[model samples]
Target: MADYTTAARPYAKAVFELAQETSQFDSWSGRLQFWAALVSHPDMSERLAAPGLTHQDRATMIEKVVGDEMDEHSRNFIRLLSENNRLPLLPDIAAIYEELRAEAEGEIEATVTSAFELTDSQRDSIIGALSRRLERNVRIVNVVDKDLIGGAIIRAGDLVIDGSLRGRVENMERAVVN
Candidate 1:
């Protein structure tokens, strides 16, 4: 799995550079998102992987669906992927490209899980605190898990701040046993 991600890095970088060079990054982003969704569809994935389907036919289907929505560069990129039998890898590529884009913009994704849904003000406060701690713009994705009982957990990249009631209880148990 790591090997696959390593192999995909070059392709993802090349596409991102191409988009940046042509000033089509946003357009490509939108189009690739569309293509990624289409490619992931059960019907389309089956069609794309069928041994009987020719590369040209796959390209044709892609063009038919997104031709009007995408720029020429993106369409050509898709054609190249189809021609090289790499359509199935578009999702990973798109994800990597988005990661690069976000990093470039000094933004990081943080997942916040709490016992209840956070109010807008609470969410904003959390984002502010995380931004100060991370020294980067924080994008919060909030989730509610009643099992958490109280407080919230924050995960950003390799850092996880477990402030939930469950974590505190576990820590207390460990201390008593020690």
Candidate 2:
């Protein structure tokens, strides 16, 4: 059997494509979140997993909760998942869909950990630098880690820049030992 992510990828891609074509990115995100939350709830999850309930019955239960909140596209998407017994993968599907959406929009989320809190000017400066370096619009989340001693460590997707004093010390120590 395949992992849940493997099961989820196609669904995510389909939803993402539809959302992109229709410019309904936020709406799609909301719809995926609703079904994902519904199916992942403790009570609803047990009911959904009950061997006695037919697939159609489980689907109906979901529709009743979703009612009037979503549009036709979202409703149809949920029905498809139910018929295929893929309801349990909704949360994973939503997450991957969001990642695809963000990638398509050329947005990157970064976290910078510094020894002290950054002023607004400092944060703005870092964002500007990262945007230029990555060539993508950067969204920053700041963190304070005193163990850094000074400077900061930046993490963006697969890229990590370690400018922390502690990191430098470790690198230097390794070089001397080598």
Candidate 3:
């Protein structure tokens, strides 16, 4: 599959700059998310892939569905994507836009996968540790995987810490084999 992030970066940066200039970051975030979800729907994807629809036709269909939710600037953005055949990159654009937004706001989202759900105190402790280590506000998303057996695996951006029992056991097995 093609890597859409490289193509989506320019669009995401442009939109982010516009949002920053206008102090409309939240507004643009919502708009991008809505458009991304719409375009990512299976039905919409199928329709968009169908032949014979002109770029204008595709943009108009999306605009009609979006209705009053989109302002003039947003509609124009959609048109530009349609004209450039970049409509399918909306998801990547939105995701990149969010990452930009988070960076600007000095925040990072982390995910913790564990054998069991974390208690409120445990969650708070993890958040505190990550915040202190990263020197940024941290938000965690918890995922439970029983196969982990114990402990947890924490992922924050490029950093991943695998403290799960399953991971430790695997490492020990590898060491023994070697």
Name the top lDDT candidate: 3
Candidate 1 per-residue lDDT, tens place, 107-170, comes to 9999999999999999899999989998899999999999999999999878899999999999
Per-residue lDDT of candidate 2, residues 101-157 (tens digit): 878999988999999998999889989998999998888899999999999999988
- The RMSD of every model to the true structure, in order and in angstroms, is 2.1, 2.5, 1.4
Which pairs clash in the backbone of model 3? none
Q: Relative to the true structure, how large is the alpha-carbon lDDT of every model? A: 0.84, 0.90, 0.94
Query: Which candidate number has the best TM-score?
Result: 3
Q: Which one wins by lDDT: 1 or 2?
A: 2
Supply the TM-score for candidate 2.
Answer: 0.85
TM-scores, one per candidate: 0.87, 0.85, 0.94
lDDT of 3: 0.94
**lDDT tens digits by residue: candidate 3, 104-172:** 999999999999999999999999999999999999999999999999999999989999999999999
Where is the poorest 10-residue window by lDDT in model 3?
1-10
What is the Cα root-mean-square deviation between model 1 and the actual structure? 2.1
